[model samples]
Target: MKSHSEMKEIATRLKRDIIQLTSANTGHPGGAIGAAEIVAELYFNRLKHDPSNPFWEDRDRFILSNGHICTVLYSAMARSGYFEVEELKTFRKVNSRLQGHPSRHDLPGIETASGPLGQGLSIANGIALSNKLRNNNSKVYCLVGDGELQEGQIWEAAMTSAHYQLDNLVLIINWNDIQIDGHVKDVMNIEPIADKFKSFGWNTIEIDGHNISEIQSALDTFEINNGSPTAIIARTVLGNGVSYMEHEAIWHGKAPSSEEAKQALEEIGTSTFESDLIY
Candidate 1:
C-alpha cells in the first residue's frame, strides 16, 4: 500500500503528465489536472485493480463517465503498468489507443467508451448489478463531472443505482464547477448535489478532491456495504495546480502551447518520472 505522501507524489506526476500530453497534442487539460489526486489515489492506493491482468474478473471497475478528461486516466493507467509509459506520447495521435475520449475496445483497462456525457453512470449501474448477481465482491466506481449533472439521464441513473441498493457502486462527482461554457451555476445550476443524491437513497460523502487522506477515508467509509449506493462530491479547482489556470473556464477545453506548458510544468515542479519526452 502506498503511503499518503507517496500517493501525493503520484498525483503530482499525473498532473505533469496531463500538461505534457495535452500540450503535445490537443486534449482537455483543466478537468484532467483537477482530477489528478482523485485518480491517483484510486489507481495507486484505494482500488483493487491489477495492471498486469487488465481483465481480471474480480478486479474493481473504474468508469470514467466524463471522458473528456481522459488525459489523467491515461496517465494513471500507463504509470500503473497497464501499458508502456512511453505510449502516452501517442495520445490523440493517428491510430493511437489513447484518444480524446476513452474507448474500452481501444484500451485494455477502460471499462467503457464514454463521450456523450451522462451515460456512464447508467452503464456502471448495470455492471454493478451484474456483479452483485454473480456474487462478485468487486466494486464499480464511476467518475462524473459536476457539469454533467445537467443531463437528465444522470439523475435517472442515480435513481436506478439507489433503487437496486447497489452498495457495490460508487459515483464520484468531480465538483470542479467550471465547464466548457462557464461556471456550472452560471451555465446550469446543479447545487444541492449531495442532497439530491441522498434523496435518491444514496450514502453521500463530501471531501476535498485534492486531499488524498480525505479521499481514502471516504472510500473506506463506502466499503462497509451500507445497503445503499455511494456518491462522493469531490470539491476541486478546475485547473488545480497551476495558478494561471485555476478557476478559469477557458482552460476547460484548451491545451497549453509549448511556452504555456513549460510554465505550467515549472509551476508543478518535478516528479519521479524520468521520461524526458513531453507526451
Candidate 2:
C-alpha cells in the first residue's frame, strides 16, 4: 500500500489519464475528475484485496453505482494493477475492456455492471446481506452520485439497507453540485441530503472529498462496528484540477482538445501524460 501523499500524487496523475482517455469526446470527465481522491484513497490504502488475485473470496467489494463516471474507477483500477494503465486510452473505443460504463465482464475487480441510475445501492445492500448471512468479514462499498439520489430506487434501497441493519455497507456519495443537465439543485433538488440519509437510519458523515486525510479519517472512523449502514457525503468540485472545466456542467460529458488538455495538465502541475491523438 502507498502512503497518503503517494496516493494523492497518483490521483493527480489519474486525472490526467482520465482527461487524456476521454479526449476522444465520448466519456464523462466532470464527476470522474471530482471523485479522484475518494477512489484513489480506497484503491491505494483501504480496499482489502490482492491485485494478483482479483477473485479471492473474502475480498471487499466495491460497487460503482453511478457508472457514468467510470473513468475514475477504471483509472484507479489500472493504477492498482487490475490492468495495464496504458489501456486507459482505449476508453469508449471498440473491443475496449474499459467501456464507457463499467461491465463486470470486462474487469475482474468490478463487482457489478451498472449504468442506469438508482440501482447500485440495492445491489450493494443485497451483497451486504449475503455477506452477513455467510458470516463473512468482507465489506460492501458503494459509490453513489448525488444526482442519482433523485431516483426513487435509491431511497427504496436505503430503506432496505436500514431495515436489514447492514453494518458492513459503506456508501460514499460524490456530492458534486453539477450533473449532466445542469446544477442538481436546478434539475431536481435533493437538498438536506445528509439529513435525509440520517432520517433513513444511516450513520451519515460528511467530508471534503478532495482532502485525502479527511477521506481516510472518515473511512477509519466508520471502520468501527456500527450496526447500521454508513454514508459519507463527499462535498466536491466538479471538473476539479482543471481551471476551465471546474464547476462547469458542460464538461460533464465533453472531452478536451489537445490544446485544452495541455492547459488542463499544466494547471494540474503535470504534463508527463501528454498525448496527441484526437480520435
Candidate 3:
C-alpha cells in the first residue's frame, strides 16, 4: 500500500487530470474534483484488482453510484494503469467510450453502468447479496454523492444491505453539501446524515474527506468484525482542489474553458502531459 504522502500526491495528479479531461466545457467538475482523494485512496491503495485484468476473480469491486463525477474515477483507473492516460483527453467527445457517465459496455474497470441517480445502491445490494450467497469474501465499495441521498431507492437499498447483514459492503458518501442546483441543505437537507445511517442498522463513521491519513484509518475499519454494513460519510469540499470552483453549486456540471482549466491546473500545483494538451 502507498503511504499517506504517496496517496496525497496521486490525489493531486488525479485532480489535475479531472480538470484537463473536462476542459472541453463538458462533464461535471465540482463534485469530481472534491471526490478525487477518496477515489485515489481506493484505486491506489484499497481496491483489490489488477488493472491488467479488470475482471480478475476475487478482486474487490467499486461502484460509482453518483456517476456524474466519473471523471475522477476514469482518471484514477487510467493512472492505476487500466488504460493509457492519453485516452482521458477523449472524454465526452463524440462517441467516445469515456462518455459523460460511465458505460459498462465500453469501460473495462467499471463494474456497472450508472447515470440515473438513486439506483446504484440497489445494484450494489444485489451484487453484495450474490457474493454472500456464493460464500465469496470479496468486498464491494460504492461512492455516492450527498445529494443522491434524496433518492428513496438509496435508503431502500441501505435497509436491504443491513437486513442481509452484508458486512462486506461499504458506502462512502461524498458529503460536499452541494448539488447541481444549490446547497444540499437548501435543495433538500440530508443532515444528521450519519445518525440516519446508524438508524438504518449501518455502522457509520465521519471523517475529513481530504485528510489522507484519516481516510485510510476510517476505511481500515472495514476489517472490523461486524454483522452490518458500513457507511463512511466523508465531509468534502464541492470543488476541493480549485479556488474559483470550490464550494460552488453552479460548477457541479460545468466544465472549465481552456483558460479556466489552465488556472485550475495551476491551483492544483501539478501538471500532466495531458493537462497542456486538453481540449
Per-candidate TM-score against the hidden true structure? 0.98, 0.95, 0.96
Residue 113 lDDT in candidate 1 = 98
Off by over 4 Å in 3: 271-279
Candidate 1 per-residue C-alpha lDDT over 134-153 given as tens digits, one digit per residue, 9 for 90 to 100: 99999999999999999999
For every candidate, C-alpha RMSD to the true structure in Å: 1.0, 2.3, 1.7
Q: Which number leads on lDDT?
A: 1
Cα lDDT tens digits, model 3, 1-279, are: 887777878888888878877776388999998998899999999888899999888888999999999999999988889998878888887777887899998988889999899988888888888888988888899999999999999999999989999898999999999987899999998889999999999999899999998889989997584999999999999888689999988899988998898898888886432333344
Sliding window of 10 residues with minimal summed lDDT for model 1:
270-279
Instruction: List runs of model 2 lying over 4 Å from the truth.
Output: 271-279
- How do these models rank on lDDT, best leading? 1, 3, 2
lDDT assessment of candidate 2 = 0.87
Model 1 earns a TM-score of 0.98
What lDDT does each candidate get?
Answer: 0.92, 0.87, 0.88
